[model samples]
Target: MAEYAEITYTVEDRIATITLNRPQARNGYTVRMSDELADAFGRADSDEEVRVVVFTGAGDHFCVGADLSQGGFDFDGEPDGPWQEPAGRCAKRIFLMNKPVIAALRGAAVGAGITITLSADYRLAATDARFGFVFTRRGIFPEGASAWFLPRLVGMGTALDWMISGRLFGAEEARAAGLVQRVYEPDELLGKAYELAREIAASTAPVSVAVTRQLLYRMSGLDSPLPVHELDSKLIAGLPAHADSVEGVVSFFEKRPPKFTLEVGKALPAYLPWLDS
Candidate 1:
C-alpha cells in the first residue's frame, strides 16, 4: 500500500504535517491520498499532544486536484444508503475535526485543492501561489462544502463570480478577498505556517482552543453577528453546566491557567442562527 506513491504524515513539536506526496502528478489527490488524509487528521484530532495540523503538497504544486487517471474522479464507492455516501464521507472528517488545520500553499491550488484549502481553518499561501476553482470547466459542481465555505469566506458576489467563471487568481487577490489569511515567499510558506501554529498552540490551552474552534464554526454560518452571539451565549451557558467550565472559571480567578477535560464526543449542538424573523 505504501508503494502508491502519495500522501505522507509526520509530527514535530506538536504540529502534525500531512503532505500530499504525489509531485509526479502535480500532487493530484487519489482515493489513497484521501484515505491517508482522513487517517492523519483523525489521529491529530484525537492526540492531545498534537495541537495543530499543517497540510500541504510536496514539490512545487500544492495540489492540482484529483488525478482523473486513477479513475477516482467520480467520488464513487460503496453506498450504505444515501446518508452514508462516499463523497460526503471522504471529506466529513476534515470538516468535523476540532483541531485547527492550516494549509500551506506554495503552488497551484486548483479544483479539489481549492476545496481542501477552503476547508482549512486558515490558509497560508506563498506569494506566487495560484488558485482556481475549475469545477465548472470540468462540468462538475464544487464538492466538499466549497459551495458553502467559499461563499462564506468571500461573500456571495465574489464566490459566484469565481465559481461561474473559474478564473485563476493569485496570492494578493486571494488575500484581498480574505481567501488566504497570510502570504509569504515560496521558501517561507511552511516556516510561517509553523510559526503561526506554534504561537497558537503554545499560548492557548488545547481544549479551549478546540472549543473556540467549534464556536467559530458554529458562528460562521449565521446571517449576522447578533444571531451568532445569541447562539454563542446559549452554547456557553450550556458549557458552564459542565465541569470543565467550572474549572476554567475557578482557575481564571486563582491566577492559574485552566486545564480542561475533553468530554466533547460526537455530541455537537444544533444551533441554526440564520433564520430570518
Candidate 2:
C-alpha cells in the first residue's frame, strides 16, 4: 500500500469522506496532495455505491492552500507544460466531477482551498472558518480557475474585491459575501455538512444529478474559453493510468495508501460538444 502524505478517504453508507490529512501544516496541499485528491475523487466517482462526497480537514483547518514548505510551482519554465497536469487535475477535476461534493470547512480555507470550496455544490463553514485568496499576496496570478469561477459565483465586483486584495474573511463575513452556503458553530460544521450531503444524496436521482452537473459547468465557462470539460476530461483520461486510481479504489475497500505510477499525459480526442441526438 502506498501511503498518502496528506489525504485520507473512506466510503460508508454510499458517501465518501475525503479528509485533508495534514494538520501539522493546517492541511496545506503539496503537488502530492493534489495528485492524491484527484485519484481519490476518481475512485469515488467510479464507485456505484458512493453517491455523495464530503470534504473536510483531518484536524483543525480545512486547507491553507499549497504547502509553503514545498514552495510554489515553476510555471515560468514551460507554457502549456509539465505543471499543468497536476494543477488541472486537482482543481479542475473537483470542479468537473458529476457527483455531489459538500465542503465541511473549519479553520482556514485560503487560496486553492477557498477555490475548491467555491467549486463544491454546498459549503458549510465553521463560525470561525477563515477564507482568503492568497495568490495576489504571494506575488502570483491565480492559477486554480478563480479568475474564471469566482465571478460566476459571486459576481464581478465581489470577485474583484477578493482576488485583488487577497483579503482574509471570517466565516460570518464569508457567508454574508456569499462565499459559504451556511455557517455553523465550529463543532457543528461536520455534522451539518454531513446532514446536507445525506439530504442531497437521498433526494437527487443519480443519472439526472450527473447530467445537471455537466450542464452547470458547461454553462459557466466564459465566451472566450474553450469548452473546458470536454478538453479537461479528455486530457485526464488520456493520462497513463496513475497507480493511485487503482490503489485508491482498493485502499478504500481495504484501508491502505495507493502506490502510483509516475505522471504521464497522452494524446486524446479533441475538446468538443456532446452531439445532440
The lDDT leader among the candidates is 1
Clashing pairs in 1: none
Clashes per candidate, residues 3 or more apart or on different chains = 0, 0
Candidate 1 residues 91-124, lDDT tens each?
Answer: 5676777788999997888887778667688999
Off by over 4 Å in 2: 1-3, 70-81, 85-87, 220-277
Q: What is the lDDT of residue 266 in candidate 2?
A: 20
Expressed as tens digits, the lDDT of each residue in 1-277 for candidate 2 is: 1456679999888799989898988887666777788888877777777778998898888888877674555333455655563445566767767688988998888887777656778888898898898778989778667787788777899899888999898988778867788999988889888887777666554544665676677655657545665555664575455344455566678865434332212211224343231
Clashing pairs in 2: none
Q: Ten-residue segment with the worst summed lDDT in candidate 2? A: 261-270
